[model samples]
Target: MSARPRSKTRATWLTLLGGTFGLHRFWRHGLRDAWGWLHLLATLTGLAGLQRLDAFGIDDAQAAWMLPLGGLSFAAAMLATILTGLTPDERWDAQHNAGRSGGTPPSGWGAVLAVIAALLIGTTVLMSSIAFGLQRWFEAQAEADLQTPQRISVPR
Candidate 1:
């Protein structure tokens, strides 16, 4: 096997920061998408909508938060794809590989995985804290109820 030629120095960091603008997409393999960038923009901006959705009986807070987070990750991935270029199919020989390859594709999916793991851990911490607070509240209520007993009188 021949040595892999180096593409331009990794611009992934730029792609990551400028994902909302889709700057990464342009440099990776000469690709572009305005709508996907729009989605990223929406994910970045529509965070308030997620909270209001809760008032409309969408009580699944985790899902509510996660959807937007996942959307952001998806947008980031799109940006990453734009920035990283799609993976090269492995059928070509050295010359074709040289033509087709665009440096090592930044692992957009891997980045998404890391984001998900961090979010999950954060969610768990928040949920446990809430649960602990609720448990304490109920315990306090039970104590109050025990201390304040109903009285009964003898009946004739």
Candidate 2:
């Protein structure tokens, strides 16, 4: 038996809000999909890594461990959102809205919102990564400068 028809609007919302946790995938494919489980696990692990960073202190070298986890979660979420948003209505209906009556097509607002969300989220993530890199670089530079001996100049 086929799964019941799923609404693209609801799916898009889920993908936007919880794509990293695979809630959207679970909505699409149910609980048995390993990919969904993987997404969920990776997201949770990433969250844990973030907590670890906070617990360990931001300046601690170990805090860097969270960077990749955070990046992966953000990237996965963005990808899922984009794919769900860009999918044509007929295709979405074929893959997910099968066996149902006149299925609702995605609204223009949904597409527009998805585009906006993707841009905002993508930009935030990119900016965050660049900031993290700059912070680390500055910290390293400070440490190196501290370690190097400074020549004392006499005012002549």
- Using lDDT as the measure, the top candidate is 2
- In candidate 2, how many Å is residue 95 off? 1.6
| Prediction 1 TM-score vs. true | 0.30
Give one clash count per candidate, in the order shown.
3, 0
The 10 consecutive residues of candidate 2 with the worst lDDT sum are 62-71
Predictions in order: lDDT? 0.47, 0.73
Write candidate 2's Cα lDDT for 1-156 as tens digits: 554567776777788888778887787778998878887776676677678777887775655645655556666777778777778878888887668766575645776587579768966875785687578778888999999999999999
Give the alpha carbon lDDT tens digit for every residue of 1-156 in model 1. 454643322343444455445555554434566655564565554444455555554444343444455355444444443434333323222323465434444344554543454445445544554564455467667878999978999999
Those runs of model 2 whose alpha carbons end farther than 4 Å from true positions after fitting are 1-4, 59-61, 130-156
